[model samples]
Each structure stands twice: as structure tokens, then as C-alpha cells.
Target: MTEPQHILVLGGGEDQLPAYHEARRLGYRVIGVDRRPDALGAAASDLFLCMTTRAPDRIAAMVGHLDVAAVISPASDAAQESVAELSRLLGTPYQPAPDAVRASVDKGWFHTVLDRLGLPGYAYAQSSDEAELRRAAADLPLPVIVKPSDSSGSKGVQVVADPAALPGALAEARRHSFTGEVIVEEMLLGRHLSAEAFLRGSTLATIAVTERSTTGAPHMITTAHTVPAELTPSTEIRLRSMIMDICGELGHTDGPVNFDFVVDAADEIRFIEMGARLGGNGMPLLVRHAFGINTYEAALRLALGQPTELTPRHHRKTALRILTADTDGVLLGVDGTDAVRALPETVELQLFAEPGSRVHRYTQAGHKLGYLLLVADTHDALRAAQARAESLLRFRIEPATPRAASAAAPRSEELTEQIR
Candidate 1:
């Protein structure tokens, strides 16, 4: 008899739930970590602890006495470097160099890398203080975006339409930044897309292209994401070529990478940002439903020192449409959750808020109250599933504390400052 292989998963949160679930499907022993005690992923883990997944040194100490097989984190940017650091210490196959992971976490380092690679990116200036930031913004193009250099989930992102709005936007962006630094960039307008791919020891596996739609502005909470993003063959090939160049430059090995881009009216693809992990917002999950391939599981296999399966098993149209509250209130309940779940088109449904739970309009991914995963054989069927979701599933909210209601309202890209 063989002892089960123990895998150290770096994050244990709702956003990381799929990783834990996939580990179980593969029958691997999973040890999960996070900062909170009540995290949903923690509950699903075989062993759970309250610890910051960002501390690589501390994590290394935790596994000091154990013969851990490999360390990996799926759908996590904050855990990327930690995983790399620990795996390097352990001499594992899933190792991505610490320098590359660090650059991914620090916007300043990321910008420098992109410039060196001659990747098409935005003109930007970095500032550490209000006085310096204000002075820097004064000269940049109008309607520039202000955001934390070291944060995720659009936490303190804001748009400054005019010079007068720069001060407030800077304050918000600074608040979310752990380093107290922010970046201001030239705002470009166009369609938002994400390139989902894998890097296996320098070889690129261009898997899926995703269409990203977010609330117009002011926190830019993602509203809907369509998998296998509809793209002309020429456009897809161009995007994949650009992605291969990026991965080649970054030196990504044995893991997934997600990149967001904006294609302007001129058809030029400008880089929005890059995340060196499985994409959040139900992306890896949607890929599994539509293509019958689980990238998250592939990450685990890579950690286990095995080859991955990237071939498409089925061709289906899929969408992950998230619903947010319109106003601040207590959730009464979703009307047809069971019905939505029963529908054949419904692949998965997750409701974050329960009856009497406080809910409100979107500020970030956390503010979303519920989500519906849909799958169909045709694009038209996919649209019908989304439409049925909107009609049958409803959020019942009555007035509560208006704090959430007072969040920044949505604005158009032209009307607000957009950033990478």
C-alpha cells in the first residue's frame, strides 16, 4: 500500500474553493492555509489553519518537518510568490522563479519588464506620496486611472475624469495599496479580453480566450464572463502570438497565466494587466464545464510531478454571469434558485448571500450576491440561458444601513478614468 501524497495549497477562501474540491476528486491529501478562520475553502480542506498565505518564509517553516510532495496555489496572485519560494526551497517541479513572481506582484517591476520586452503597454508614472502623485498626474493625459500598485480585486481603483478629481481618486487608491504607492496610466477605450493559457517548461498551450464585461466604472466589478471568447481566427492567432511572447519573456514554467487586454478602435491590443495564476471570477470552473478540462486540476498534477491534460474534450458555449444588488438592503432570498439549478443549461449556481443577509451594489468581487454558471451547445442557447437566469433568479432587497448604497456609482469608460 502507498501513502497518499500530501499537497500544500496556499490559499483557503471561497475564491479558492475549486482547488480544494479538485484535490478531493484526484484523491490527494490537501493542507490548506489562509488568514481567516471561517473561510469556505478552509472548511473543505483536510487540514486548515489561519495564517497569511503571502508569507513564504513562514510557510517554509511550517513544512520544515514534513516530506511534502509539492506546494501549489490555484486562482491566486497573492500566493504566487509564496508558492515559488517554498517550491524552490523544496526542489520541486512546479517552481517559477521568485524574481518573476515578485515582478508580477509589484507593478513597478512589472512595468519595467514589459518595457524591456517591448510589449505594447501604457505610458505611466509611479508615485509614493500625495504631493508627488498630484504633481505627476498634472502632466499625464486627461482621464487617467489611479489604482494601488499592490492590490487585487479592484479594491481601491478609481477614475479621475478631470484634474479636480485626482485628489480624491489618489486617496482611494492609496488606501488599498499596502506599499502606499500607486500608478497612473493612459486610459484606452475598447473591448476587454483575457488570454488564458499554460506554460510547460517554455512551451505555450494557448487554451481559452475569455470575454470580460465589467460594470462601466468606479470599482469595475466583473458582471459577466464568456468562455472560449468568440474571436475571428486572425484575431485569436494574433492574441496567442502576443501571449507566447509574454510567457517567453516572463520565463513562466509549469503553471497557468491569465492576462487582460483592451483592443482599441484601431485594433491595437494594449496590455491591461497580467495575473500569474488561475483566473478568478469562476474562470477555471467555467473552462471545466465547457471544455471538460480542469486547469486547476492540471496545476495540481504539475505539482505532483506529472504531465497535464490540456486537450478539449467537448466544445460547448459557457458563461458565468454574476448578479449584484441594485441598492443597499438585507437579502430577502433568491426567488428561483432551485429552478435555476434544475435547468439543464445551469452548470453551477452559488449564492453568497442568504435570507436576511446584508447585501448591496458592487464595489468589488466580494459585493456580488450570487452567480449562475451556464453551458449550451450553441451561442444562441447560451444567450437564452443567461436571459433565463436574469428573469427567474431575482434578488429581493429591502433597505438596511445605506453605507453600501453610498458606494461609487458606475460610469462609462469615456466618462471616467480607466487603468490597467
Candidate 2:
């Protein structure tokens, strides 16, 4: 009898859970590692290693100790490098070159490479100084976007409509960035869509396109995502072609890839960014529900150099709506969760915070209180279920206590001088 393959899943964010589940479902002995001892995915793995994913030696040692057949990371920038480094140490064929992964991690380099390839997309400039930022703001069109070159989940991203706000936006960008470099780009107006793909060597397989709904103002965090992007067949075909070409250029042979884009009023597709991992917010689960394809399984299979099954078994509508708190304070309570869970289309309701947990003001996706997954036969049904879920949701938070203002005390020297 042959021994079962062992797979190592790095980190345990909401996005990494599906990979762990699918690997186990496929009969692979899975191990999950994270810096946090209480990470969610740790509960589901065969072995849980609480350690730093950035430590390549530790990871390599763990992989060897467990005899892991493959190392996989989902929706993590740091883990991507860790996987590459571990693969190099283990003599595995599963990872892209470190330089190629670096190009994807650094937004400035990604844009430069795409531009050099004459890819169809918006123009972008990287600024590390105030003068350069001001110049870029002057040259770029109004309603431009400023964000950190290496950040994800929409952090440090601001849409500036006026030149006067550029300085403050630049400061905010620098505040969230470790590299001290920000990217300024021309804002393209269009319907946002995400296409997920799996690659094997030079061959590419398109999974499904999802329509994304994001917060419009102060934040660009994704609020909802619906599968089977509401696009005509021709547009979907074009978007898939673009994704395949981009992945090929990036040398992404195996594993999951998500490409985000905007469909302009002219029906043209503009590339935004691509992550070399699974989509977050239960997107992988939603895709499985809609298409009868398991992206998580495909990714593990590819990483193990095994054959993958890429056929879609069904066509349905599925959506994930993130529950966000409207205010910042200690979470007093969450109401109507049981009622929401009773809905027919409600697949899962997950809350990240406890009653006494301190919940900050919702700014980015990271601040979301929880998420609701819904599946239905049609887009209207899915939207209706999401609405019902929202109606049943309630968050009670205490108002934040304001800091006391310091009282100004008169100085004795100033008073004596005035008297003199």
C-alpha cells in the first residue's frame, strides 16, 4: 500500500481554511501553520504548527519532519515567499521563481512589467518623495488612486478627486506602507469583476468570473461578491484571455490566481491587480457551490504534481456578504444571528468578534465583524437572501469614551514677567 501524501497549508486566515478543508477531503494528510496559536484553520489540520511563516529554515524543517509533499499558501503575501523558499530548499517543482513572485508582490514592478509587455491597463507611477508624488498627482488625471505598492486587502488605498488632497493622501499612504513607496494610478470607471484561474506549466484553466461590490467612499473594501459575473459571453471570453496571458507572462505555472478588472462603459476591460492565491471572503466556497468545481482541490493537486479535474458540474448563483459594524467600540452584543442562519440560502454565518471584544471602526476588509454566505438559483434570489441576512443582523456597541483635554496651567515665570 502507498502512503498518503502530506500537504502543508501556511497561515490560517479566512481564505486559507478552504485549502485545508479541500486537502483533507481529497485524502491528503494536511498540516496547518500560523503565528497565532488560535488560528481557525489549525483546528482542521492533522498537525498544527505554531510558528513564523517567514522563517524559511523552520518551515523547511517542519516540511521535512512531516514529509510534506507540497507547501501551499492562500491569500497571503508573506506566505507566498515562504512557499517559494521552502520549495527551493525541498527541491520541489511547485513554486514560481522568487524573482517572479516578487514582481507580483510589488505593485510598481507589476505595472512596469505589464507596461513593457504592452498590456492593456491604466497608467501608474511609483512615488517615494513628496515632490515626485506632487508631480505624479499633477500628471495623472483627476479621481486618481493612491495606495501602497506592497499592501493588500485595500489598505492605504485612497481615491483623490482634487490636487489639494494629494498631500494628505500621500501621508496616509506612507503611514500604511513599510517600503515608503506609493502607487498613483489613473482611476478607471467600470464594473468590477474577478476571474480565478489555475495554471499547470504554460497551460491555463479558467474557473469562474465573479462580480464584486465594494464600499464606495472612505474605503475600498469588498462588501459583497457574486459568482457568474453578470457579463455577456463575449466579455467573459475576453477577460479570461487577458487573465491567461497575464498569468503566462508572470510565469505562474501552478496554484490559484485571481485577476481583478474593470469593464468600462465602452465595454473594454482594464486590469487592476492580480493575486497569486485564492480569493478571500468565502469566494472559493461560493465558486464550488456555483460551478461544482473545487479550486482548493485543484491547487493542491497542482502543487503535488498530480493531475487535476477542471470540469464544471453545475451553474448556480452564490454570494458572500461581509457584515460590517457601523461604529467603533466594545461589542455589546450581536442580535438576530439565529434568525439569519434560519434563512434557506444561508450557508454559513461566521463572527470574528466576541461580545466583549473591542471592535474598531470599520475601515478595511480586515475590520469586518463577520461574513454571511448565501447560495441561490438566480442572482435575484441570491441578492434577496443577502438582503434578508442584512436585515436580520444587528450590532450593539457602546460609544467610545472621548479623551480628556489637558487643562492649560499658567506659568509662574510668565505671570511674574507680565506683572513686571
Please tell me which predicted candidate would have the highest TM-score against the true structure. Answer: 1
Query: All candidates' lDDT scores?
Result: 0.75, 0.76
lDDT of 1 by residue, 385-418 (tens): 8887677776766545455356464233212111
Off by over 4 Å in 2: 1-6, 25-31, 42-51, 61-64, 97-100, 399-420
Please provide, for model 2 over 161-251, each residue's C-alpha lDDT reduced to its tens digit, 9 standing for 90 to 100: 9788888888898887767888888888889877776666666665778888888755577888888788888987777676666766777
For model 1, give the 10-residue run with minimal summed lDDT: 411-420
> For every model shown, what is its TM-score relative to the native structure?
0.89, 0.87
